[model samples]
Target: MTEIETRVLRPDAAGIAEAARLLGAGALVSFPTETVYGLGGDARDSVAVARIFDAKGRPHFNPLIVHVPDLDAARRFADISGPVEALAKHFWPGPLTLVAPLAEGHGLSPLVTAGLDTVALRVPAHPAAQDVLRVFDGPVAAPSANPSGRISPTTAAHVLAGLAGKVDAVLDAGPCPVGLESTIVGGTPLALLRPGGLAQEDIERVVGPLKTAGDTITAPGQLASHYAPNAAIRLNANAAHPGEVLLGFGPMQSDLNLSVTGDLIEAAAHLFDHLHTLDAMDRPIAVAPIPNCGLGRAINDRLRRAAAPRT
Candidate 1:
């Protein structure tokens, strides 16, 4: 494919407006969310949506998450139920994505849901995301702004590095605060599809004991081998293998530390950025054991997937 020069736009009012205009015109724009940057296109425009898949070389079966400005806008696309409503009331404008039944005639591109009856939706808390979504005033189908099954981008430079020539523009709003994807919750019994920025305990607190989703590819980030880097990953390692980089937690003398103080929140915020750093080293990576609690569960989940053998 011929490379197209990608523009990195400022987060000012004019930049947001230009990004919105590009989305309306069926162009791909990468913008920051509280979690990760998303490569977005108008959800209603199949041509634009196809560009997202083509740009990332994403699989057709993996669904895209539609980001709306607020709950009212979200309601227009998905049939939000009481449980979904309760979760949305508390977690919307934060880091939780609710996958629900798609409303009839919702006008979303069929490609967004991969012909499934459901659609993934979220109201991102990022101010730039809010401004762009509000100005665009439509559903924007976006996946993480990187090549398929690779490390998610937490900064505008990461987006440009992976997709600079493929996307029309990237909204440069600096590094993402939450360095993980949103926790995806959905299904009739309200299962946790993907653990991410929001802790599983917090979601269970909102909606009782949540069931774990089965091994089905119903949502984004559900693939067996995903969120991987170029180098092979070894998990729960006490020390790096020969020539391997050690990504340590709670610091016991490693090349890099997620958090020396064992703060899971800080670790979650730095997870992807650190992975990006380690991947650039062009060496195998080893990670210390992360406790399976709170945000640590989400971190471990991502690490395990990253370590999974590639197909």
Candidate 2:
């Protein structure tokens, strides 16, 4: 990829127009999704999709989630099973990616699927994202808009700070409400490939029990040591260890609190933003224990990966 000036486009008509134009030309554009900002490329363009991997330094074998405008659009790429369709019907236009066998003549670059027989598809609900996808009128292969295995970007500044010059532009639309990635569910008899912004309980209510994925990297966010910061991480801490910056939950004195009221949703929203802040301080991070319930499960999932030994 050539070193280009990464523009920060506003989330307006002109901005959305530019984003679509760039994407159509097979250029990488970082745009807002409800979960986190995504580095988007034309899913059908092999060169563009390859640039995404180069920009993020992401592994070639780890597939990306193809974001589309609607279920009809998603169906054009991947087969939708009864359970997958149920989840999509319940969670589409929101933070959920359904992985299924690739449809015949899907027309996607093989890079999007990492040479697998399946593909991951998502329909985001963010208005700005909808505008871009609708205007672009095509599937976008997007992964979280930060360097691979690093903290996901919740704001445009984070994107610029991490991916500036590597990508073409960022459609800045402020912070993401859901600060985690979408839950990836797929395989025969639907399995939860990754825990993310959407809660497991909610998905179960919609599609019954979901089988858990094994060690294999079947989808995005399944990487063993992803969503991490450069600094060392310590999870489930009651208090900050000496020389460690504490990321607090439920308001005890600390460097920063995910939510003083102990609300998991609030904590989930603030997770990456807070981690970005502390990681900038050049110190280790100690995170307070978040309950294994609802969004906390996603929060803890990310924290555990952050604390995992770096390969």
Candidate 3:
């Protein structure tokens, strides 16, 4: 395959318009969202959606999230039920995704859904994302802008590091604020598919208690081993082993600190960037124990998956 020159576009009016034109013409574009950078393509175009999976080496069975400008646009592609509507009203423009039954006659490519009957939908809070979606006026199927289960990219530099010559363009809008993927809520009996930037307790407060999904890969981030770095990762370590780089949280002396103040929110924003840093050091990575509370739960979830023995 011939290499595509990836343009680094600013998140401005002209940049948004050009990015939208690329998507409309079935080219892959990586753009920033509140959670993480997403490798996006026109969801309605099977060929374009196929490029996304091919570029990332993503599995066909692992579905992609369709990001729209607003809830109304989301309803055009997904059968948003009452519960999903309630959740959207509260969290549409943030780090939350709702998987609902695919609406009848929805024109999304089967590749985007991975042949599943449900469609994952999100309205990202990032200004660049909103601008791209609005100008494109269609659903863009996006997954973390990395080589499929690798560390999610939180900045344009990270996206280019993994996919610079692989994708068409990347809209640089600075570092992602959330720095984690969106929390995915789906399935009957209402279970949490993935823990992410949005806390599980907050979701439970909005809806009732949510059953955690079992080992089934019903949504993104369900794979037992994902979000990995090149270096081996050791979780919940008090200190780094010899020749290992230490990633610490909450006032711990280490090679790099997620947050010196022990703030989970702050730690969440720094997670992937720190992982990228440690991975580049070409040393084994050790992480100080993070408390399993609020955003820490999501942080630990990513760490555990990152530390899981790669297949």
| Best by the lDDT measure | 1
Residue-wise C-alpha lDDT for candidate 2, range 54-111, written one tens digit per residue: 9999999999999999999988998886888889998898999899899999999999
RMSD of each: 0.7, 0.8, 0.8
Alpha-carbon lDDT of model 1:
0.94
> Please, what is the TM-score per model?
0.99, 0.99, 0.99
**Full candidate order by lDDT, most accurate first:** 1, 2, 3
Model 1, C-alpha of 105: deviation from truth (Å): 1.6
Runs of candidate 2 exceeding 4 Å displacement:
none
Deviation in angstroms for 26 in model 3?
A: 0.5
What's the TM for model 3?
Answer: 0.99
| Runs in model 3 lying further than 4 Å from the true structure | none
The 10-residue segment of model 2 with minimum total lDDT is: 215-224
Which lDDT values do the candidates have, in the order given?
0.94, 0.93, 0.93
Any residue pairs clashing in model 2, and if so which? none
lDDT tens string, model 1, 196-245? 99998999898998898999889999998899999999999999889999
lDDT of 1 at 257: 95
